[model samples]
Target: MNLIKKSAIALCALAMVFTACSDDDNDDKNTLGDKEGILLVTFGSSFPDPQETFKNIDNAAKKRFAGETIKWGYTSDIIINKLRQGNGEGSLKGQIIDNDTPQEALEIMVKDGFSKFEVQSLHVIPGEEFDELKEAIHAFKEKYEGVSVKIGRPLLDSDADIKAVADILAVKFSEELKDGPVLLMGHGTPHAADAQYLKLQSELQKLNPNFFVGTVEGIGFDAGTTSIGGILAELDKLSPKATKVTITPLMSIAGDHANNDMNGNTGESELSEQSWKERLEGKGYTVNTVMKGLGDYNEINKIWMDHLEDAE
Candidate 1:
């Protein structure tokens, strides 16, 4: 080939390479420029299946708010430390890195120049954990005056939220409610805000007469109210001749409490302590434990998405 023709061909090839590199660089720049994001905050769970709860919520948020980024933060320090120290459960070992405390996650996001943050709490009630998350967001608002940080309400934050969640659970567990009473287990708190659970129970029972709510903590019971024990007592009265009971976690994720404390088989003799399943079975009731978190349900997840929209 002539020298001039060969030179022209080489120039065209170099130009093509340059154009490809330019397009790749622009793509990275565009991704970085989209700074608005959702910081999904949850009380981290060590259970492997519950890890998908975060992913599900994150995916929903991303779909609802397309073009926005998504990050995760856990409210528990112990879970964060456990995962960081490489001591989480076998299935969760490699899946817990993003499970840092909300503060750590927020700070990291800010450092990365994420200026617009929608902090969505995966907490069921507006209890201690939700309060702490709100406080963190407020602190961030003060410190980073230029950044925009808006807080999303917990699942049962308002009267509407309570009613909506009740309706969703009622439908999700309708089959069990048809056969036997359905009992939901929540991680109740000692905080005064534990009153949220009582309100939630009221709304749920209104939807299904046999639906009942209980807490791991006893803070939710009062004059006319019921604790877990109280709910169990009510169950006995409601079904004096009943032989079957259905139990499920009312929390966002069916983590340790759901898997072990509530449904651990008594046959695992090393962990021989009787769980809720054993306790109910001991009461002569055939217990059917459902290993599902509230977040596992799509309608329940949409409630959080709705809260995000309302907050926005």
Candidate 2:
């Protein structure tokens, strides 16, 4: 071939190679390094499934931040106790449950070296606990010179959250038990939590007439209002011969509260596995603890799909 023609072909080949190299470099720049992100935060799980609460939160995040990278972190001590694995040999089994206190969780995340953060809490409301979580996030963001963080609200406890929860749990009630009583256990606060309980009670009643939904809190319900004796007294008044009743927790995850406080027995309780089965059998109504978290399936899913798409 002629020298001029050969030179022209060589120039074109060089141009193609340059273009390919530039594309590769751009791909690397876009997908790797500080450009990638992770969302770190968790909700307060009430045990056995402390790990599961993070699992629910992580599932939601993965859906919300599909293309973007996200690493779930816990904010609850209840969960840390059940932790079995982490970023180690059996890393695949390593869930997000952690042994870190509020401050320690942040340190671990910083040590892993992330740059951008979108913190989402599974809090029921932007109440005291939620506020504390927010403070923690802000502190972390400020403490870490280069980290970016944003907070998300609790799904179930939104203005319409109680309503949504009522709808979700109404499915647990049977038609035959339309007149039977239903009690929902929630981690109620001493303050605004009463409002949440009222809201859920109202919503559940509207959804299904069978359940007169009421809440028992670590703070609110005592033997007078929520004390086991008071509740049993009312149950006797309503249905002395009633053969069955259904109880469920209104929290996102049914961990310790559902298992222990709601079901546990020191004197007389039915549902807690640690307690006597006879206590439940003696109750006459036949106690059953609902094993699902509010964020169990569909509710958790909506958060994930919606958020991930928005993040994209």
Candidate 3:
């Protein structure tokens, strides 16, 4: 009887050893498993107000791409410097924002064992900034072997995107459109992609003739048609002569351009450099300014999210 008991005990020990070996193999497979990370790149702002929009975007991305490690990258060195300083008055007072550049964020992700990466740009157009981002992404790809990298296009990359954005804007400012014409201020670039603003303008006009799109830089390939002066000239040709106008920023964040350039006053004289608001008011048009950015709209954010999805 004692011999039989010893044999049963030895059999149980062998079974336990086999189960432990199987568990170790599975653990090793999981340790070297496929890992993915997402990097959201944008021309970041220095102000605190835009942080809310960023927060909303982060939340949306987290909800959509759950279980994936997410990170942020700011393209603007000036803004990043100011944020790091954290000693300026007003917006920058007592605020320390730590953000990584596109290259830095990707490096960190690679160090964390993420072999697959998806980069999403939050710019309104594929302008100079987006071009630079693409270059950076390309360099990153060349530097890392066996690492998969994909980048999403900007907000207005294709005809469908232009049409979709115009539709959303038309609906967003439906009430404002009823009151008067709406003038949107975009950040223009000398890049060939600047023509996107013109395309967007055409689409917006198709939806509503009162929609006018202009740029602050006024240095696009077709400057004559996309500049602020161009928009003012078109406004002059209005048959009924729009007496009231609603001015807003078409940028991702309503930063310096929206707050100061679009709505700020020089306060020196009417002859000095004038904001869009002042310029419109000079024409005897009652101007209503909306200090909201494109990022403030969930519908607009979804379009960006869709671009990321396509990239993935």
Candidate 4:
């Protein structure tokens, strides 16, 4: 009887040991982090490219500001646009909304107990949106009382920063591109876009004048389509049939303007930018638009890398 009892106790002990080992293995397999805490903030991503573009910024932040959690605070427009575009199942470009605003995003995070935020704007310039964001961030900080938040600078803070970005932009054009004119597609706004594009165009030309450089906006350029045609017309006048045009976007990360306005083909609206390539071809010039974003380039990635330091 004593031997049987001792054998039963030994069997129970073995079962308990096996159960503990199974639990340990299961914990290892499900190694994911908790989302209640992190660092960093931005407007919001409507599509994957802009989201991924910001992700590139986050990745840079990760490399330099290691040992910190990076959290994203996105506007309701991103959520709504994403959902209306079939629950974020489709491309992010379709995620833009007419009524989207920024203040509510920070409010959502604060309501959820976020105490600190490095509110960075992905806006290309310090124009209306950036100005509004700066004010909203300030209001949020003042209202929160115990929390901390700071607004980061725009992409057009200074020309050295522009050259830093332009030098980064320079790497994308190959040396073979020396014979081909490199045209950058920028969102020429009624406000600062022309000045910014002019600055970027000058910097790229300075970097390498072996290629001609020009920019046309989605709006604000005098005779919008004509500016592009004018550049091509001049190139045609100079080189005739030998013109090799490489068009790349000058915008912060080609979200909608790069993908839709520059590349879309059905010629949707008269207000839409007539295909620059089609226009150049009509003038007998060989046209090629480079469909890549500045954010993805290694050197372009350095822009955020340079800024993350100030983030500290």
Model 4: CA > 4 A from native: 1-51, 73-102, 210-226, 237-242, 268-273
Candidate 2 or 3, higher TM-score?
3
lDDT of each: 0.79, 0.56, 0.83, 0.59
TM-score of each: 0.83, 0.66, 0.83, 0.70
Superposed Cα deviation of residue 173, candidate 1 (Å): 0.8
Q: Please tell me which predicted candidate would have the highest lDDT against the true structure.
A: 3
Better of 3 and 4 by TM-score: 3
Order of models, best TM-score first: 3, 1, 4, 2
In candidate 1, what are the lDDT values of residues 33-125, reduced to their tens digit? 337777888888766888777777777887898988788898898888887776766676335338677778877886686777888888988
Model 3 Cα lDDT, one tens digit per residue, 250-305? 99888878877789886657576688887788878899988888888999989998
lDDT of 3: 0.83
lDDT of 1: 0.79
Off by over 4 Å in 2: 1-33, 36-40, 43-53, 78-94, 101-113, 172-179, 212-230, 233-241, 267-283, 300-312
Candidate 2 weakest lDDT stretch, 10 residues: 85-94
Alpha-carbon shift of residue 266 in model 4 (angstroms): 3.1
